[model samples]
Each structure stands twice: as structure tokens, then as C-alpha cells.
Target: MRITTRRRLTRAGMYVLFFAVLAVVILVTDWGRLAQQFFQLDIARDQFPEIITIALKNTILFTLISFVGGLVLGIVFALMKLSSVAPYRWFATAYIELFRGLPALLTIFAMAYMVPIALGFRVPGGQVGAGLIGLILVASAYMAEVIRSGIQAVPKGQAEAARSLGMSPTRTMGWIVLPQGFRIIIPPLTNEFVLLLKDTSLLFIAGSTVLTKELTTFARDGLTNTGNGTTLVMAAMLYLLITIPLTRLVAVLERRLARGR
Candidate 1:
């Protein structure tokens, strides 16, 4: 009846219940069927070299392009959002709100199909280009807010110090505030990179040539050809291989930043 004894008994019961459920599930499951569907080594082998060289390569490439494009545009939008000029603030706000409110898939579809048709403009690299552009636009909207918060988080004293030392407002912001703000925001930015990496899977909606296909498309194609889930499993593993390290890096950066603070 003591509090500590009751707590230990409850914990032991929870553990027992968890194992009981797990044992029943394992007993009822068909290991042979599961292996045939998702763990067929021969089917998995067929996807080899190309899965890594082509599918995964394209995923990483698309992510890098989108992240770099987004970061540059995000910085510009963040600056505009903070600008003294009313029009700049208004435009930036409208853009951020619009993209943030829209589903990324819808935005990608529009970029790939609607915008080009309406404007009679061709996006270079065709569908792939438009998909990347859409990703950049969505990413910039989210990142603009991140960058804006980071910039605002910088101490006002740093800007005042720079101004007192004869730096112009622009110079102070560019040299002092922005750099310090970036340092403050590195952990979140790294986390954004991980999210963007996963987001590259959405590019399959825009369609791709075999050469440009990322992991999801590649796995789906493999599934169609092999009629096994192994390809999907392989693709999932590749995604984990890339994202797990980046996520761990984000945690490390956060801890380091906290220590610095």
C-alpha cells in the first residue's frame, strides 16, 4: 500500500501486459508470408546499385537544391518582413501566409501544371524544375519565419554597439545581427534540412524520367515490377540512413547552443 511499492507494481504490470500483447501478435503473425512480401533478399538485390546510385542520389540532390534555394530566398523574405518600408512588409507577409496556408502538394501541382499553363511560361528542366521551385517556395515561407525569429532573437545591444562604432544600419545588420542570428538558429535550420530531405519524396507528384526519379518513385516502380514490398522497405531504410544522422546532428547542435547560452 506504500506509494513507492504501488508505483513499482504498476510498472511491472505494464511491462507484463506489453510482453503479453507482443507474444500474442508474434504467435498469430505469418513469418513466411511477411518474408515473401517485405524481406525477399533476391527481390531486394535486384534493386541494388541503381537504388543507391540513382534513386538515393536524386533524393539528396533535390534536397540540397531545395534547401539552398529556400535558405537564400528565406533570408530575403525575412529581411523584407522586418523592413521599415510598408510595401516590403506587406508583400512578405502575404507571400509567407499564402504559401504556409497552402498544402505543399497543391503548391507543387500548381507549379508543375497550373502556373506554366496560365502564364504560357515554361519552367526550365520541365516538370522537375517546377517541382523544385514549388518546394523552394514552400520551404522559403517556413524558413522565412525561422530566420525572422532568429534575427529578432539577436540582442539589440549588438546593433547599438555597431551603430555607435560608425556602422550604418545595413552594415550592422549584415555584419553583426545576421551572423549572430544564424548562429542562434543553426539547430532549427539543421532540423529544417531533415524535414526538407523527407519532403523531396513529394517531388514524385510532379513526375520524373527514370534518371530523375527519387526514392519513393523508384520504390513504387520496383514494387510494380517485382510485386514485393521489399523495394519499399529498402527505400525506407535509405531514408532512415540519411535522416537519422542529420536528426542526431540537430540534437548535438541544440545541446552545444544551450551550453553556450
Candidate 2:
């Protein structure tokens, strides 16, 4: 046989062996009992209303608020970082690096605990508000980088052409560069939003009221109440339900962008 044929057969045999072992393990394991306890529909149904109100609602709210906040700050920072102005560039650079260098959990904790103590003023939702602020801070840092890269990816020729047509720098950026840059960045930004959706789970550490609780907290509370993991499984499914459509959108955007390339 040819060497290529032999190699293909060897790879196929390895895959077959892997699946055979997987099948044996699944058959030997108590998966039925595991499913009965963890995937109990009655327990999930009992917890569904609270899960929808607190977990799903709050998770969506956090994501939208953080994304909007991050997007606004991200645009400002991206422009500043790209500017010829020294102080603006320095400030934007420092802000981006400072937040990006820290772990997100640390930022969330500090915002929740340290900010209130230092400012001597409490926000509306207390810990949850603080957590949302932290999410915005961290997300803005990442988004600033993404926006900067997108802006910079616009060809210098495009700017020059706009200038030659008597457009001011601000107008050129607004009318030409940003529109193209945003198109290029859309898929990655969508992926970032998906990440932000998942990262909202970290807010559980900041403490939440019953209505303010996100998916992780809701699931955890249910786990305690029922002594079963049904809620966790349900929450996982709900997250998948929310995320899967966005993921497909990202895939479509990526494909379209690739074709443009």
C-alpha cells in the first residue's frame, strides 16, 4: 500500500480505538443515576420562574449595560490612543494597560468593596452595581484594544483620500474610517459580547439580591434549596440557548468578512 494510504488507515484506527474506549466507559458508568439526579425535569420546572426572572433577566441586563458602557469608553480610548496628542495618548494607554493587567475578579471585588468604602457613598444596587461597574471597566479595556486595532487597520490612503476631498480629520474618521473599521471588527466584537455574557457569572461573588442574581447565583441558590444540581443544568441550558444564536451570528459574520478578505 502507498505510504499515504497507510497513514490514513493508522489515523482512522486511532479514532476507532478512542470511540471504542469511550463507549465502554459510558456503558460501565452510572450515567442513568447521574442524569436522574442532575437533570430532573420536575426540579428544573419548580425553579424555572425564579431562574427566568433573576438569572436570565439579570444576565441579559448586565451584558447590555456593560457592553454599552464599554463601547462608549472604548471609542473614546481608541481615538485617544490613535491620536497624535501626547497627553491623550498617554492617558488612554495607561488606562488600557492598568485595567488589562489586572485579573477581572480582582477588579470586581475592588469595585464592590473598596470603592464604596473610599467614596463613602453607596450605589443603588450596592454590590451588584459595583460589579457591573467593574465589568464595564474590564470590558472597556479589552474593547479599547479591539477598537484601536480596528481603527488602525483602516488604510492611511483612505484618510489621505478623505483629506484630499477637503474633509477634516474628525469628519474623515466619522464618515469613512469608522464605518469600514466597524464592519471589519463586527464579528470579533460579537464574540466579545458573548464572552461578556459568560463573564457576568463572576458577579455572584459581589452578592446579589434575589432579583439581581445572574445565572450562576440562581443555579447555586437552587442547588442549596433542592440539594440537587438540576438548576445548574437548567441554567447551563439557558445560557446555551442565549449564546448559541450569537455564536451562529459570529460564524456568519466571520465567513462574510473572510470573503471580503
Candidate 3:
């Protein structure tokens, strides 16, 4: 057989395998039971204004505050990592690697509990605040690398032109380089926000009041109260509603970048 014929046969086999598995799943699933358990609109309705007002609001608030905090921290560290000063570079490198290597859960736990116990320091705003700080630490670690790469991606000539125009190094970075670097980084930074939004679910580790609860904690409590899976499904749907559009935007930005290039 020719190479194209062999490839065609392979593709046909894959389609057959895919549909066979899909058919098996469809046949095995009990649609009525699934809906009864997970699609209880009556129980879902009980979730009410609180889910939207309190849980989702807190989730969004946490994500925005952490993202903004992380962005600022990321910038400082990124600059430090690029500094001519050896100590600054070393400290930045250590911070990024250490946080990136640790689980966000552990960091949140430590911030919420251990810091207060060991250091005798109260993390401002209590457990929820500590969780946000932990998130900021982890996020900044990742964003620092993104920012450094973005800054480096700025054409050296742009900085050179600014310098030649008698701009100080700081002024060149501030006025000329950072604006372009941030533009180049917008897609990745948007992706980071999506990740942070999901990570807010991890704040469950830090505990919360009803008012402070985010989606995951709220949904877990609802699951207990309703004794049905509806609230969990609702939480999943809400997460999708928030994430899907952001994910689509990332793809669009990537495509636009490709086209521009």
C-alpha cells in the first residue's frame, strides 16, 4: 500500500475506536439517575442569592486582589532578577524557585497557621488574608518568570533608542521597554488570571465564615445541606462560565500574535 493509503486506514481505525468507547459510555450511563442526583433544580434554587452574592463575589475578589498583588510583586522580582547587583539576582532567583517548587496548599496553610504561631505575627485580615498572601507569593513566582521573559523579548534596539535619546536606564524601562513588554505579555498574564481564579478554590484550606467562603467551600457546605450533587455541579458550571471565556480569549490573542508575526 502507498503511504497515504496506510495513513487513511490508521485514521479510520482511530475513529472506529473513538466511537466504540463513546457508545459504551452512553449505553452504561443512567441518564435519569444522573439528572436526579446532579440536576436538582429545587435544591439548586436553594443555593440562591448567597451563592452568587457571597461565594462568587469572594472568589472574584480574591482572584483580582491576588492577581494585582502578584503582578506588582512579579515586576519587582523580575527587575531584581535582571539587576546587575549579584545579591538582588540571587534573592530573586531563590524566591522564585522556592515558591514555584512548593505546593500552594502548603504555603496557604503555613501562612494561615504556622506564621502566626511561630513568628507571633498576625497576617493581616486573618485566615482569608493569609491565603491571599500565599496565593500572591506563588503567583508572583510564576509571573516573575513570565515578566522576565516578556521584558527580555522586547527588542534590545528599543532600549538602545531610548538610551540614545538621553533617557536614564530607569526611564527607558519605564517609558519605552515596559509598555511593549507588557503588551507582549498580555496573553500569558490573562492566562495567569484564569489560573489564579481557579486557585481561589484552594482557599478552602484556610477556612472561612459564610460571608468569606468562595465557590468550593460554599458548594461543599451546600452538598452537606442538600445531600445531593446539584450544588457541586452548579459550582462546576459556574467555574466553567468564568473560565471558558478567558480560555477562549487566550486562544484569540495567541492567534492574533501569530498573524502579527
Candidate 4:
């Protein structure tokens, strides 16, 4: 009882210290100015719709395209990495490491300027098209790692069992390993989608026409028009609105996967 009492006192002291620090910070900072800039009501209403239409839409579009592209390419990369052939594994590993190490913005810039110049070809939607391709490349690297791990997580016995049942190597992998691996990958893949949604903001660096401008760009334009920061806040809120649901979905998937395991 005495030890318990002492522990309670220590906990209470930590809380008091935290509150004291918070009070000092509040007193030292310009709370009124921060509130006025970030929480201006009329400005939020004026800019929020535009933020939603441009930023939210583009973010969703980028994530969907990148997720689809990554899913397809990641599966192939994972298979290559798992292959018995030396060159396939080497090529897959090199591809994954190269894109994973590079910044998404640099990749987008290359796709926008360097690729087009080198190839002497126009990307269909100009900067937007280039940005999406860049996102797909970067996303594929990380997704490849996720998929490789998932495929590896499957029991070796499952492959042997399939082969014993007269399944060819390709058939065994297609029928047994991939389905189980995909189930294990679902939660992490959803998390990757959430990350991709946030990363779409980097597209602004590649530049876009007004119609193609995403959330950050749209908010910046709104800020310039209204001379207020409310647009930025609105953009943040809309991103949260979309991402929060996906995050919750990820949690549910994790629980389901855990239970299945």
C-alpha cells in the first residue's frame, strides 16, 4: 500500500509538471494570433469547397492510380525476387532499392522534364501524367517490399504440399501461395494507400494547370485570393476526412487478419 501510494504521487507530480509546462507555453506564445489565422470562420467557408474539389479529388485519384499500378507491379517484383533465377532476383532487388532510395519529388521532376525530353514524346496530361507515373514508380518499390515479405510469410510446407498434389511449380504458386500471401498483405497495402494519399501533395512541385492543381496548390491559391490561412486549415481538414476513414478501415482489417491467423 505504501509503494502504491508513492507511485500514485509520482504520477500526479508528472501530470502537474506537464500542465505547468503547457501553461508556460500558452503564456509565452501568441495564442490569439494563431487562433485568428488558423480558425477564421468566414474564410474557411469561402475556401473549403475548392480545397475539397481540387486537393481531395487529386489526392484520391493519385492514390487509386498508384495503388493499382503498384499492386500489379509489386506482385511481379515479389515473384521475381522469390524466383530461383539469379538475374530475376537481382533485377527486382535493384529496381526496388533504386526507387525506394530516391525522393518522390525528384522522380516526379525527372518524369516531367527528363523523360519527355529524352524520349521526345508528350505525356498525355502533361505534368499531371508525369506526376502519377512518378508516384507509381515510387509506390511500386515499397509495395514490392511489402508483397515480398507477405509472400515469404507463407509456410514452405504449403508449396511442397501443392507440388505433391500434382500441381506444377507455376500452378502451385498461383493456387496456394499467392492467395494466402495476398490476404496477409491486405492491411499493409491499405496503409500504403493512406501514405500514398499524403504523398500526392508532392505533385505540386511538378506544377499543374489550374484544373489539375491538388489540395496544397488549391489552398495556396485560395490563401493568395483571401489573404488568409484558413484555406490551408480547410485543406488539412478535408485530407483528414478522407484519410481517417481509410485508417479506421486499416485497423479493422488488422483485427480481421489477426483473428484469421
Any runs in candidate 2 off by more than 4 Å, and if so which? Answer: none
lDDT of each: 0.95, 0.92, 0.95, 0.88
- Report how far residue 91 has shifted in candidate 2, in Å: 1.5
Our model 3 lands, by Cα RMSD against the true structure, at 1.0
1-261: candidate 3 lDDT, tens digit per residue:
999999999999999999999999999999999999999889999898998999999999999999999999999999999999999999999999999999999999989998889989888889999999999999999999999999999999999999999999999999999998998898999999999999999999999997999999999999898789999998899999999999999999989987987
Model 1, 12: alpha-carbon shift in Å? Answer: 1.7
Task: Quote each prediction's TM-score.
Answer: 0.98, 0.96, 0.97, 0.92
lDDT string, candidate 1, 70-111, tens digits: 999999999999999999999999999999999999999999
**Model 4: runs farther than 4 Å from truth?**
1-3
Model 4, TM vs. native? 0.92
Clashing residue pairs, backbone N/CA/C < 3 A, model 1: none
lDDT of 1 at 53: 95
- Per-residue error for 141 in candidate 2, Å, reads 0.4
The TM-score that candidate 2 achieves is: 0.96
Error of 2 at 88 (Å): 1.5
The runs of at least 3 residues in candidate 3 whose Cα sits more than 4 Å from the true structure, single-residue gaps closed, are none
